[model samples]
Target: MSSTTQKCADMLCHRNGVLKCSRCKGADPETFYCSPECQKSDWRWHKKFCGKQAYVFDVELLGSSNPKITRKVAVPSWYTFKQFHFVLQYIFGPWQNCHLHTFSFLKELGNQRIRSDFSIRKEILLELCHEGDVEYVSQNWFDEREVKLSDVYEEDGRLRSKIMVNGNFAPLLYEYDFGDGWEHKITFVKSELARAARPLVKEAVGCGPVEDSGGIQGWNKVKEAFAATQPTTEQLERRQWAREVSGLEERYNPLAEPDVIVMNYEGRWENHEEGYREDERRRTAF
Candidate 1:
């Protein structure tokens, strides 16, 4: 019999469970189901976890001209690389997903220190092979949808801790928009108990760069134009371009604080508060 102190894992059912999931029997904070029917209904969400643990990560955007932009988030190990991509899109710039992306893993070879010259590396591409895409038959390349966070960070998210060198964990690199080269370093923080089905924002800092604002250099120019008291013709044109690309009616403020609440929600920023409230209600209901 399952624990009587806890309710069913199903969001819609709070009744005490009589049966536990065999697959996740030994998982910490194990899942329970009142019946096979309830378990079947919740399979869509539960399959992601199976029995894997959750992990917290510190994702920092690198090469940004602005102050260091970072986000601390909690995500389930079962989340696919594609799902993780969406999480990054939401937190960074609340970015519009208009470009290609890829996640790269760097491994240490001998005493090389895992710098850029490593002979061994793996890349997870946005697509394995599309109709018009060139074929990459090597094992090094994988489809984002086919890989999960757990597959990379094995041993229940302790892979980083084992590889820690000089008190620093090796970071997983993610690149978005090949042209602009929006690179981020994803470092493992710690393991966490499963709490929410959706990714949660633990912390956020600095606003993300506006889309189509070039790279760091271009973004700096946009900032300069907005900050100028007496604008030059080039500055005025740059400001207009920033506003037009970002769909902002007013001048773009690079230093504006990021809204964590809005970032956590999926839809438009206007309905973020309502979405947050609804999520809270559901969380507390059980």
Candidate 2:
């Protein structure tokens, strides 16, 4: 007789006969073998549930008249910003998440479901979604959100939205044939900040970043697309916030950025609390 429910040994999971493995698409493939030892032994299959090493970085960088300007950035609480996009891709897919970035994506990722702390790391949170399929539902703002219980497939990314802007959180898909394989992508309009300026920065002085746009602006966005830069955090204030977010701080390199592992508290929305203020050192042009 087929059992209605089974405990999964791998992924520490529980399975209803109706639901199958997302990674294997296996139907009740004896997930639970009735022992903790059985589950530990079955981790090879569970390992597939995780994606490629999350730190896919593109080394292209932006040029600045001032050398002190951030070559690296860090987002608060997270070491690897790829964790965000990885979850989005796993929950949705690369193309769907690309469609999610068309607007003021600068502030759209801040939703409760988006930041839930299921595990010490955000990537592990994806494990919860791996157990089921995700569906997309439109918010009144016209943007889409995920519903794992309702939809068969869901994939996308969103920024922190303070004011709701109505638009479809829809997927705009793209494809590139690599001969050996077809690479898919999602297309969307990208916008740049128009702050009154200092010197105009280029993605690279002579050689442009991989993106054809070829300006400081292009570098910022392109590095991410190329998987070069990940959002990083530099704790402007350590006693107040750095201690809260950092796991460990070891020296990065000598000569230039000696304090390579700077504090990153990007999501903090508090008053600036710097005790000592020194005029920032000016950088001679490189």
Candidate 3:
């Protein structure tokens, strides 16, 4: 038989028809889930990208028993719900139209945002104006001469790049430092990002910025998944309080003096104090 559908859908991967899957046959399907456990574990996010297209085993569809495998399997970058949500909307939306140029990876190119956890906060981001030296960026070249016209090196402020695209963080050239673990880079890009690579970017269009309505249901599912990641402060504190109350119940003593009991309860809510300044261990940072 000819060999066409015997490989996984991921072109970079070479799974030798070993990664058994129940939902789909042949190579990796649209979701590329290796097993049912994986599909269910990440169903919220996976359903979004998998779309509704049925996966036809490469060799089977081609009427071949085994084809020369030449697929490139790609690993996803974002891992958490928060990251998945942001990528689907921001990075994937407009940037989806542009070619994804991943610069960092232990192995593999054309991949970035590993496990997909990324976000942009306006609370700390410094904003810039339009009419700046943005024309140079559109030319697909980092021209120092053109950059001099704008005060891009002030260090105290940010450049006005993607501020127009991202409504909240607007203007891309702004930078941020998440922590010691992250690489601080500029965000947003108004003018042309890759002039020479325009064709590649065009081909990459419609890959990200998933509207709430789109996705084979993967988009909305991811939104729900992102929201489900963390328990609210009230929820956690309430649970903690319940355990504390149970412990106190076990330590109950009917012989304790009323005054002592009253004093203990009086100082219990010191957690909500906002205008007090004394003591090394009784302070809450938030």
Candidate 4:
């Protein structure tokens, strides 16, 4: 049912509700509540199946090491690709949205993998394209602003027909920071409703890499240097380099827990909307 017309799932209340169940926000037959009190009151019955089914994903940073970085997140199916990008940034290092990114779809053909002809990219990339690049942009790219997660995956969490290869769905690839080549493999883990309208992190492992600390190889070097017990001269220099580059007064720790709360707050779509509107106003003023 459309979000606007949905009624409170509390059988007795049946009020036209706006708040979705924290654990079942994106379920097919979505559950809602008019108030937290109603939701709490209904918990006894609802808890049985609240988060049993929904859109869940495992996002792993492709080249992380020392401990390997990964996160399990529950995302609403209606989220746009742009929103997904923000979610990734939040869960990872709370990455500074300083670079361009793309979402690629790949199909398996026998033993070889082929990237789908088209990719979804940030809207700023399209805006930056010159007139001469219009055809190329149109043929190879889709604006992330226009595509929802549901457009790529079915309500049942299966890949849609057109994009499926040999009746199997492929994991989606997200590449951020073209210069650093920070690639993340996004694998659909299960069909389960998320806890909120915003993506929720269910699990997190290892620490996110330092921005501009080079790429995977550079990050690995930093880890090796810091992990050393009896440091060699070169390793000491490397540690010094990492500190300077990362703006850390002390050695970088690869195992520390990320500041997830701050990340989620900064990455909220509402904050993005405010920034986007301000940018639009500036552009129009000029």
TM-score of 4: 0.63
Reference-based TM-score of each model:
0.64, 0.19, 0.17, 0.63
Writing each residue's lDDT as its tens digit, candidate 3 over 1-286 gives 1233444333445543224334334233333434445446654543433322211111000111112111111112212212222222222222121111111111111123221333222122222212232321222223222232122322221343322233333222211111111121322222211111001111111122122223223322333332344856754443344334324433422122223222223132132121112221232242
- Arrange candidates by TM-score, descending: 1, 4, 2, 3
- How many clashes (backbone N, Cα, C below 3 Å) per candidate? 0, 30, 43, 6
C-alpha root-mean-square deviation, candidate 3: 24.7
Query: Which runs of model 4 end up more than 4 angstroms from their true locations?
Result: 1-54, 109-140, 155-159, 232-237, 240-252, 257-286
RMSD of each: 9.8, 20.4, 24.7, 8.9
Candidates ranked by lDDT, best first? 1, 4, 3, 2
lDDT of each: 0.66, 0.24, 0.25, 0.64
By TM-score, how accurate is candidate 1? 0.64
lDDT of 2: 0.24
Candidate 2: worst 10 consecutive residues by lDDT? 271-280
lDDT of candidate 1? 0.66
* lDDT score at residue 230, model 2, on the 0-100 scale: 40
Q: Given candidate 3, what's the lDDT at residue 169?
A: 31
